[model samples]
Target: MNSSRRLVVAVAMSAAFALCLPFTANAGHDDNGTDPDNRSQAVKGFNLTANGTKAMNHGKSQLERSVITTSWGGGDIEVYDKDYGDNGWHGYADCTDWNALWTSCDIIRVRFNQYSYKTSSQWKSLGCHEFGHTADLGHRARSNDTDNNSCMREEIWPLYYDQHDLNAIKAGT
Candidate 1:
């Protein structure tokens, strides 16, 4: 083929490949435990105070009601509550172990900071957000949520997952 024809073909192929790729809002956030196989797994909590236990239980309940099918025991995911003392984050999730292929997580850890006092609703929101991370759900900015109601947002305003978050969890887990 002529040089110009080859260039045109290359451009066309590139565009096609790009179109075939899946789009994820939480693209780069999938590094730790964002494995799909973690769906329907069990989670446990450690070092939890009364409030911390409440938050963990709320998060676990949300996950169980969602399409993820997560249960409240068995150590697949370990949740912890401790005082971080103004670390600028309310909670976080990390994968402690991975599957053989590294595509899925064998064990995950979720932690909640007890430095600041939060309302019951806020605690639930934190729980939902951190747990959402284990199910491959990423943080959703306020701008992305038109209705302004999702636990995945950086702020702890919403106490439950919005439809979009639920949909993402369904697709991911």
Candidate 2:
């Protein structure tokens, strides 16, 4: 092939490969900035709020647990319940609201269902998944059941925050 033609072909192939790359299954209310240049919050904090009757129960507790455990003293992290109103809290189960600002990637709010759709364990994993997003984690493609250990995986099961997930959060920050 001609050099010019080869270069064009190579560029096309690279683009194709990038497009094929796996991404996390995320539901957001606004643009979740993927560009590192656009975000800056190094440490993330969560303000667990209630959605009216959505009391703070085991599901919320588990989500908080995931946040604390995965962070591993990454930085200033907070999880509080009961009197905190839904002022800036985002979604955890029903809907998620986020905006990757130039100053911080930390989540502004989290909204979570009381795990009415699945078992407690399943929601616990799901909670991790949602919090992972707050940590600026995207969906990752799993290679095996072991990969399911990552809270960043698109599939919510075998919920455990893997090194990859932690790294992603740190990188974003």
Candidate 3:
């Protein structure tokens, strides 16, 4: 029985690794055209939206815990199933505006294709990455600085907001 359990665990781990290998190998950013800066903002208040994809849903909780809890002026971050009709400021699973900034995140899409190909953790990390953009964070452009664990990094995984990310939040406030 112990041997059988071990086999099951190994199989599960292997599957997870396989699902994530492609992403790690090609961890490129969508590049929404913003330069990295330490401009922190207090985020007076904003109504954000997200699609109902599994990854987006999971990401919503993570963002709320890590990012929203620190920023956001006590407003609701709406999660919906439909895409933004006018593109004023919303998040979608299929949005092409990855990490886009237009008058404050007209949308925060997570690239729906990721939901089918990547693991929940990967999508969650990407979600945080997009949210980082909402906080006015650009991609981490420093190449030699391998110590960067910021979600703003072009590659998403082992997700967590670094101190620089926190500083970005404090830039405009």
Q: For model 1, which pairs clash?
A: none
Question: Predictions ranked by TM-score, top down?
Answer: 1, 3, 2
Give the CA lDDT, 0 to 100, for residue 8 in model 1.
Answer: 100
Q: List the candidate 2 regions with Cα displacement exceeding 4 Å.
A: 1-107, 114-116, 143-146
- TM per candidate: 0.81, 0.43, 0.43
Q: Give the TM-score of candidate 1.
A: 0.81
lDDT of 3 by residue, 1-173 (tens): 69999999999999999988633111133233322222221222122323234444444444454434433332223233333355532333222232343323333333333223445566566666655654445567667236867666765464666765654444421
Tens digits of per-residue lDDT for model 1 on 74-147?
56789888888899988988888888887778787889998988888888889888888887777787678768
Single out the weakest 10-residue window by summed lDDT for candidate 2: 34-43
How far is 169's C-alpha from truth in model 3 (Å)? 1.2
Pick the winner on lDDT between candidates 1 and 2: 1
Residue-pair clashes per candidate, as listed?
Answer: 0, 10, 12
Per-candidate Cα lDDT values, in order, are 0.78, 0.44, 0.45
- Model 1: residues >4 Å from true position, as ranges? 1-33
By lDDT rank, best first, the candidates go 1, 3, 2
Candidate 3 global TM-score = 0.43
TM-score of 2: 0.43
Task: Return the lDDT, model 1, position 131.
Answer: 81
CA RMSD, predictions in order:
3.3, 9.4, 18.2
Instruction: Give per-residue CA lDDT, model 2, range 1-173, as digits (tens).
Output: 99999999999999999999965433221125422223322323345443321222332333343333332222322233333344443234211223343434333333454324445565556556655555555566656325457655554565666665554554444
